[model samples]
Target: MFRGTGFGTYYYDVRQVEACDTSFVAQNLSPLECSSQNALSLNHVNSNYVVAMNHSQLKLDMSKYCGKRVIVTVNGEQSNLPLFIGDGCQRCAGGSASSDVWNAVAAPGLDFSYSVLEELSGGAACADGHIQIAWEIVDDTIYNFSDGVNFETAPAEASEERTTSSAALVMSTSLSAASFLHTPVNDDPVQNAVAVLARQGYGDATEASSNNALPTDGLLASLAEPR
Candidate 1:
């Protein structure tokens, strides 16, 4: 779910990846909100890329979003490329925003003619590189947005921004499965570190799911593969 101060919310969903000849196939993308009006279904040729957009007119200097998952379409093509969302308003920070959030990712056969940036800014200087998206836990209620999506109040400049413990900004990008598995373990230093970071961002410290927590399967997928 995407949120803004006065604007209403929108939902988005992504398709899953399927095994292809050499790599994975990315199928059609879906917007969660699209279903509200019409049961929007996507048509694609070859599954290749997933997409994301920023709809907030507010400035956005988002965190790195490589290797993350965006929307979810069960039993469909899925891509692991992470997407970085920004302000939809070009006049705003990075020229990314909410209008972008409505349109779905570029699927093989889908037509993503409508763009939030294009709608708001009349056009956009499209960013280069495959986007990496972060996925929210299936059922966990993590709110940090102005509507309590991430928090009651919005972050200064970044959508996911908030004060961070020194360690959070410096924690290793790489982590052992042990880090996630150790959640129920004693109040060890690493666990404590994760806890503080979660809270600093207005997340629940005692919640089993951490908003800061991301899917490690992608990382592990790379590591688990034969060398």
Candidate 2:
């Protein structure tokens, strides 16, 4: 939903990647008042891109997925290579008016374009000729933009195996398959983690179905195979 504050004659233009521009004519679209909010959704992957006007706010929303490792590209150019949601935007800040919140500092006098993606589901479907706000969850953790001004902080801990690199670490713990199965996926470190977990099995017994056992067999087989 691309809307400006205190609008006069504002144009909301949208274009598919490498495609011609399509314009949406809104008479009075202001962020202050609601009436011309264009709702849209996007499922983005490599090589998928869209262009639209006034997408500065959109960039902030998408920055959550990136954390510090990724970049948000605009219109075939890297304007804000590593973008973060600024503190002041009401939509991004969860609708709180805090003095501590800082407004996004965009490059002056630049009209932004559209598009973002990464696991967005169940939004009010875009009607004919309306734009949708699409997004995916890079990490579900709440990002505090005001947690100091370093954009390089990586978002969310990587799946286990990021820490520690010693097979001896697992040897220190008693290797009870039952106890191992119950171990929470979160931990300091574990070698042969996935295979070990797969060996014992997964899922609550109550939730088991015929197909539930099939994938685990393949996983165990693969893990047991020589590298």
Candidate 3:
């Protein structure tokens, strides 16, 4: 989602690869490696709001959104996020959000920092993990992150609808997977990392009857085959 305009729905999780995890670092899947300079950390202590999307499914060029700030609205709660490309996962859209951003928008009693993997995979239903969000790019002319200015409150005129081109609308939809597939995993290191994470119980036990859910069998098989 962008600004106030509605974009297509996508799944989200709060799982993050720790900076010190060697497996993630070797595969270049760590948050620090995947995100831009604007999003250096996902620790709860940092106030920088950021979200990552699977690089494979991201049809647009990374240069367009990286380092740019967007107001992400999830379940009617809003946070400012810097966009970045992340490791890929089947049927997982809007890949992950920082713990701080998750805490800000998540319902009461759901703490991402306490149990990252459980919270991500223990949702009541697959739809519970789905992120119905809307986002809008912050106008760089009005607010700049480098200036050390904080945009705690949205602009007064934020509610007013702004016109976007067909290209922008198309770009929004392209960020998500249009269909679920069981195709063989290719040579992408980011995807290989996803497979490894799955082996570590990422999405192994999630009950997903829906077609949109990630295929656990496919993820496991990726490791068995050579790229």
C-alpha local distance difference test of each model? 0.28, 0.29, 0.36
TM-score of 3: 0.28
Per-prediction TM-score, please? Answer: 0.16, 0.18, 0.28
- How many residue pairs clash (N, CA or C atoms closer than 3 angstroms) in each of the candidate models, in the order given? 40, 11, 5
Order of models, best TM-score first? 3, 2, 1
**Over 4 Å off in model 1, which ranges?**
1-47, 57-59, 64-67, 73-227
Mind giving the per-residue lDDT tens digits that candidate 3 earns over 21-109?
Answer: 21222223234322344543443213223333333433354544343455555566664333322322222233243222332232111
**Pairs that collide, model 3:** 1-135, 2-135, 2-136, 3-135, 3-136
The residue-by-residue lDDT of candidate 1 on 1-227, one tens digit each, is 34221111112222323211212222234422212233232332111222233322112322232112233221233323222231132122232332333223421111122232122222331332112222331222222122212221234435445445434645643344346634544545545544544534635444444454434424434644666
Writing each residue's lDDT as its tens digit, candidate 2 over 12-116 gives: 222333212433323112221110132222111011122222333444454432222223332333333332222122223222222233233321111122222
Task: Name the best candidate (by lDDT).
Answer: 3
RMSD for each of the candidates: 25.5, 20.7, 29.8
For candidate 1, the TM-score is 0.16
Which stretches of model 3 miss by more than 4 angstroms? 1-48, 54-59, 75-77, 80-127, 139-227
